[model samples]
Target: MQSNDGPAIDETSSSSSSSSSSSSSSFSSFSSSSVTVTITKLTTNKRKSMLTVNGYEFHFKDYNKAKTIKFLRCASRNCGILLHKSFSDEFVRFSGKMTDHSHLPNTAALGIRTLREKLRQRAEHERLPLQEIAEQEVRAGLLTGHNLLHNRRKLMPPLPQSCDFNIPDEYRKDYLNRDRLLLHDSYDPQFQLHESVYKRPEGRTLVWSSDVQLKLLFDSEKLYMDGTFCTAPPNFNQVYIIQVIHHETFKLYLFH
Candidate 1:
């Protein structure tokens, strides 16, 4: 004999899904050709999962799939839009939020927000040059080249701008004109800075190869560097030497 009774299926569980179609069709057009959008963080707090997807910001609403299925709600108190995003194997899809925005988006706000978000996204321990990032924007055509320095400053944190109340206007002008050299100066025309290394500070640590045996300099391995106080000339108390051995011939070439 068999029982006719069956396990009850909770209607509430089934109602959780908003779509009636298969999951494939539901996610196929998440970021379709018509959508030109970017996801940016709305806050710095890690626990408070607030993000702006294509200019529309939303706050965390729920957690699923080990907290990967991020369900979010519009941050604006007046707005009731909900957002759906998933990450398993790859991005499943993003949906639920309306793309229309109420306020007019200005260039200054967008520029500052993008820069700040970029700096925040980078690992806190990594060496990043904020000023250099600003300059690169001009080269990349994100900002105009005519007012290069002013545009660069806009991209960087305006610490100097707030603190430079006592600084002479002329000094600020000088910074605008030549400060680009501080992070990017090389006496040797042959050796150029890597494009990735757009920013560095003004300091004595920066150096380069110079002089005889220089021909073999680029061709060598096992480069050696040492400084001697005892053997240096009177005018030069400390003399540093860099020597390298040829890769093929195994000949040592010394350069001071």
Candidate 2:
């Protein structure tokens, strides 16, 4: 009877220990699920990628290429939250701990950031005029002021520093049709330029007019000449504009 009673006591103690261990394991899993981090990807003003978690934004601080992980830090000032994101699989997975934020999230700033990103993306891919695009975005965002948010020069070619730079072949012709827009290029003889409109050797003058415009100028009975001194290029004293009057409507059109 003593031996049977001892076996029963040992069995009860073992079951209790097993139950405690299972409860601990379940609690651990529940805690992990409760604080599961969800990451939201976004773009910075410079079009760089960033992530947001729990209304806080994080930017990349470092990268671990071999481990396929990205280390990020809170964008807010003095915020100590750090994140480790794993990119080894098809989806991004979050790791490590994040502390409580020092201040509340600024939803206005976040909205502005999102607005700027949208403006930049529209500027990049769309063929619509910039003014039209900006107006549409401004109305959609309910933003004030007429200032454009995106960089205007993003799609434009870099301006040449000096007159000695080479002109690209595409720029030499009209964009609508492949017609010669550059009538003369004195510096570069390879262009097979026309004779200079002004014969002065010291103050060399360049003129641009299509063949059709020249024909119209010759056919018109009345011609108008206007010269602008203030708007001329730095090297020139004045810019002369020749105009022709339409026969039927009497409207003036630029001839040169």
Candidate 3:
């Protein structure tokens, strides 16, 4: 028999109590597992900070803040395929070191002298005109000498004065006389003929043709004449006489 002060427990109520206890235990296990995962995350981040590749230490501080590494195919003409990519800093440093002045060959020091000697020999072998080669040699010698003199602290000589000699009276008189004779000799009869033939008319005259038929008719009968003149003794005057011939009889008539 049941006691009067206590409530009787049902099967369903007992099962419900067991399920709630199981759920509480599972929740505690999950929380503890999360703590271990957070520790692993921290360790992984620390390892990442010490990462290295191909024996080169990764120093982010040496790089500019805005700089970024690019993955480009190798740009060498012989190896354009994607061999590797590099940071711009490393590439620029490598290029600059390769092109440093100390890397130049020893022969480059005497390059100009060697080139000049070779050219001189070649010019001689080809039997080129000596004057041209001499001029070139003189120019090269002058430039080389100037450079040497400048390096030694020597001053250049002053240029020659342009006005050095006085003109003699007899020479000046001969030059003037020769020029006057040349001028007098150049005034020939042919120039006089051209001047006479192409003289400007005394006054301007205007002739207008109206109709096409009339123009054609006048042009059919039109004649052209030309003549030449020669200089006379007393004066420079010359004359040219021009005549138009009649179309029917070919008789010449002086044009007004």
Candidate 4:
């Protein structure tokens, strides 16, 4: 949990943000000064907030509630007009639309956003894994199918870009940081990285090696390897092999 700016996303939580193709809605009429937009929590990245105003979904993409500076957009793919807003002393106000958008606001994408937010919240607060969450969302009629959901712990796309996928911003969240091992070894830099990607088995292997493990590998006469197929990365069903050796004194060593 990090709170200087906002809480960090759960390390295991994959970004499930995507656009909807079949839904549509339009902003009827909004007066920048007359209406106060309420920013509500969503399953979106911590920086963003989602609101449904008169059937249209408005996504506040880059918001600093403390500083009163924010950027907004309609969630619809066809009409994603970026908007601006600022607040001070409890007063909320939005500027006229900034980027190009539909003459009518599309609500289908907002519905998708809302659904995604709900799915993300389920993954977070309910303490459920991505498989459960993805299945539940589809069971609830949110998604059809996405291979990314099956491997939540690895190979996640970067968080949705509020600006654009090609152009990244400071606000964009980077999703893959799976090495809990790094945190424990950060204070000491003795760990050496030996990573190899395999094609035949269709997976990758990573090893954090130290000098003491090398001496064990060289000193032992009989070497052994223990492989398990029940657990692995990216695919989760591949085989992972660990090198092992028995020392002269009958001590066992493992390098994986």
Tens digit of lDDT per residue, candidate 2, span 31-105? 122355545556654445666665566666665545455666677648766555555212132332435565566
lDDT of 1 by residue, 1-256 (tens): 1112212211111112121110110112234234434565444333233455555545555655455555665555566455445542122233433544343333454345555545454434446685666455445546466678887778754443221123233332222232222221233333456658744333212233333356677656567777888985443346666777654554434423
Candidate 3 clashing pairs, residues 3+ apart or interchain: none
Whole-structure CA lDDT of model 1: 0.43
lDDT of 3 by residue, 79-178 (tens): 3121111242222111111211211122222333344444556675868787777677667656576678786665433332422333233322222232
Give the distance in Å from residue 234's predicted Cα in candidate 2 to where it truly belongs: 70
CA lDDT, every prediction?
Answer: 0.43, 0.54, 0.28, 0.43
**Model 3 CA deviation exceeding 4 Å by range:** 1-135, 143-147, 151-256
The total number of steric clashes, by the backbone 3 Å criterion, in model 3 comes to 0
The runs of at least 3 residues in candidate 2 whose Cα sits more than 4 Å from the true structure, single-residue gaps closed, are 1-32, 64-66, 88-98, 143-256
TM-score of each: 0.29, 0.38, 0.15, 0.28
Better of 2 and 3 by TM-score: 2
lDDT of candidate 4 over 63-130, digit per residue (tens)? 55444455555666566454444442122333333333344444455567656666666766887788
What is the model-wide C-alpha lDDT for candidate 3? 0.28
| Every model: Cα RMSD to truth | 22.9, 25.2, 44.9, 18.6
